[model samples]
Target: MVSCKNVFLTLTLVVIASNQCECGVYSLIRDLLQWNVAGIPIIHKTVKWDFDPEVSQKRREQFFELHGYRAGKYLERIGLGIDGKQRERAYQHAIRDQGKLQGLSILQP
Candidate 1:
């Protein structure tokens, strides 16, 4: 029988991996693209522009610790600015990068 510790470790890894993204980055990209195509406002003043660097750094570290280098680069590439519409490209890149790091073969519909 497998040891409890081994099972716990496996479960922990699975949980950590699942925290990377929701519905995959490709899907997010597609959504953003569609939103743009539809002439919907992509950027707004309501969006938080000044997320603390310390918090972002902590989150980035957590992402790296959980997903490793490739994933970390994905987030780094996206950046944390409050430029709403202007930041789409970076956000998309980060999402794509994160997807790659997580071993997710998801495609945008």
Candidate 2:
């Protein structure tokens, strides 16, 4: 009793719906890893930084603030995301370690 055209339309709709569902799941997983594990958002565009330390530092902080750290405490407050302060401490520690390895005196903040 079903017409061929009706069957084809149903099949097309089902395929599209399934594809959208799959895409949503993939996006959720990707966001979890990016923001929660890496403490960084998805950078959609090319970002440039200045060679000057002060300018670079300001730019970096602004970037973090604008994109936000750990999805702005949504995941972080729930303890599911990486803590921004902890990430900063790790960064500072790495800088110190690098300075020691290179035998250079790195200025600390």
Candidate 3:
């Protein structure tokens, strides 16, 4: 027989632990943006923008479509997320790569 209180505690702990991963989506984005603003060069330490560069071209195309859609729809207020080339480059090391693949199949053709 499980107590309701215990169940609630377990669920709460699970959610907390899940969010405490080494690097979460929120914190990762924040750090990436910070690095972009600071002009620091990325060395693939924590954030990884492109998980797999070997994916099919069709999948690569989806990234392009979603990139545009998401920028206009969600990131319009965030200033189009982390700019690869820096929106202004106010710092010397601004516009870090942040583990993004230099090129993808979609860009080839």
Candidate 4:
């Protein structure tokens, strides 16, 4: 039989191990804003803002909706909630894409 203490411990561990971002809302708006202030070019690595480009505005919105704005709505949005390696990869991708835009704020509330 599982003890209450054990159960609590297990639950705690699960929460700690899971990614905090599940709602899809991004809090890095502050960072993005900084980029905007610095006059850096804003490029959508995952979400394109330009409709004339190869990627459509709608597609970009969808991506932001799924992985950006939506993640912040719930506790699940803390992170990808997947494996650490995958999460790291995704983080790197976002950083590499948007890091250049540091000091420039293009995100809207």
Q: Which candidate achieves the best lDDT against the true structure? A: 1
lDDT of 2 by residue, 55-99 (tens): 888877886776577455344334433555766665666776685
User: TM-score for every candidate vs. truth?
Assistant: 0.21, 0.19, 0.19, 0.19
Candidate 4 regions off by >4 Å? 21-109
Alpha carbon lDDT of residue 24, candidate 2? 64
Choose 2 or 3, whichever is better by lDDT: 2
lDDT of 1 by residue, 6-108 (tens): 9756655554555555656545554554465435665543666765668988887797887677686556545545466647766776677785644555575
Once superposed on the true structure, which residue ranges of model 2 sit more than 4 Å away at CA? 21-109
Whole-model lDDT values for every prediction: 0.61, 0.60, 0.53, 0.54
List where candidate 1 sits over 4 angstroms from the true fold. Answer: 1-50, 72-109
Query: Best by TM-score, which number?
Result: 1
Q: Between 1 and 3, whose lDDT is larger?
A: 1
Query: How many clashes show up per model?
Result: 0, 0, 2, 33
Candidate 4 lDDT over residue span 8-73, tens digit each: 566445544444643322324333333653345555345746446756877868777776675453
Which 10 residues in a row give candidate 3 its minimum summed lDDT? 90-99
Total colliding residue pairs, candidate 2:
0
lDDT of 1 at 5: 87
User: Which 10-residue window of candidate 4 scores lowest in summed lDDT?
Assistant: 23-32
